[model samples]
Target: MHKRVHYAFTVKRNQKNLHHQLATLPRAKASVKFSDRTDTHGRLETRVVQAPAVSDLGVDFPHATQVAKIIRHRTQRKNGKRSRETVYAITDLTSRQASPEHIAKIARSQWTIQNRLHFVRPTAFAEDASKVRTGHGPDNMAALRSFAVNQLRATGRTNIAAGLRAMSYEPFRRPLDLLCLT
Candidate 1:
């Protein structure tokens, strides 16, 4: 079974640039809620209201605390989304050998999956508008779409939607070779 544990932290407002940064950490599944607040200048301030338990740090709180420290420093000082300094906590549910770097990797990976896999595919491909909202249909079609995306990405087509569209438009061999189930 997968070892899982929880921790908590805060993400500051005004750091839109760091959304991807937090999502790429190790052992992070999902956040419960993210919200917006009002800043002193009356601009919109966004924060990570809740996140999943991060499990890739060591078994004890010390290691988890170290991860939090690194998150705080990195998010605050990073090149994007300049803000007054907001902090967010994560709880990593991971194995015994998980290191801080590993913890970070899990966090990053979670974000990548959410943004690159889920959000981008739907928005770019208009997957949500297919009207296949019933049992198994949407999911099945999504799986096929994901398969196509993986094939295109494997062939060096990085933009997922574009790749899908290209495959849709092309003639016999290349696109068929891409989507073929051999």
Candidate 2:
């Protein structure tokens, strides 16, 4: 935000008041609505995103410009199981800056971010088991782990756990080559 960058993120049910406020927004007045379907992981998924006309709502957030509702319907092709989910979101960008399509893309990109960065952190580095409870210790360690992850990624290592294991097998040689230290 300080960098003049805009952001759109989901408002989960944990934020009861905000979630309820967005949930009940009148869809009839939506400024833009977009829907898309795709097949992934043996499941056919559909997403419908609607952003209502910009209005001053009672939400206690800053720089908030638009609120949106995302309804997702998923069907597993293998088992015929089905599921539905509704999610709300807030964005600092106006409708002009972020169309419904862009907002929906942002929402979907979050899952990729979680899988590529967040999920690998704990799985590759044992971050959750670390005892770095002090103020700066945890933050610094996280930065180091992120650096390592990025370095491995730069070397085209998609499976970070396997990359870490392979790097360890060669001791300082493989890692030094990646760092251009050899």
Candidate 3:
């Protein structure tokens, strides 16, 4: 089984304040401990009266004290029961001032098959109804399907399962040709 870690954080103006909050919070409490405890508590006291807001990328976060809530939820099964919990927190920090391009890449990378790809694979290719759960058979077949789907997409096939069908049923239109087979 694979581990699904859910990370939720916010962007804000006060970095030190955010760090302190992370230290005091539950899940992140142990993960992040302030090296300089003295300064962590006094961040609000030392703040400039009229500090300007921090703006990065296309968003402008206000200058006032902000609480960034970060929750990292890890789910696991124990004693034949699924256990779930969330850590609530407040902070004013962002891990990175991500570039617009970087944010887009992150968003794209978070895509899950259940939300987009899996249904198409099951509905279009009958992958779900597959009863082949033998040694290496299921794994190999899945790998081939994944490869075929990726190839089809790379070669401009709009629908994934259709590409699988074409690759599986048609010898002349095999992906190996587009795969650079001489």
Indicate the worst ten consecutive residues by lDDT in candidate 2: 52-61
Best-to-worst order by TM-score is 2, 1, 3
lDDT, candidate 3, 57-77, per-residue tens: 212223322222322222222
For candidate 2, give the lDDT. 0.87
Q: What TM-score would each prediction reach against the true structure?
A: 0.47, 0.85, 0.39
Worst 10 residues of 3 by lDDT: 44-53
User: What TM-score does structure 2 among the candidates reach?
Assistant: 0.85
Q: How many residue pairs clash in each candidate?
A: 27, 0, 2
Error of 1 at 101 (Å): 4.4
Best-first order by lDDT: 2, 1, 3
* RMSD, one per candidate, in order: 11.4, 2.6, 16.7
The deviation in Å at residue 19 for candidate 2 is 2.6
Candidate 3 versus truth, CA RMSD in Å, comes to 16.7
Q: Write the per-residue lDDT of candidate 1 for residues 42-119, one digit (tens) a residue.
A: 343444333444444333333343223232212222334554443444443333344444444544456567776788
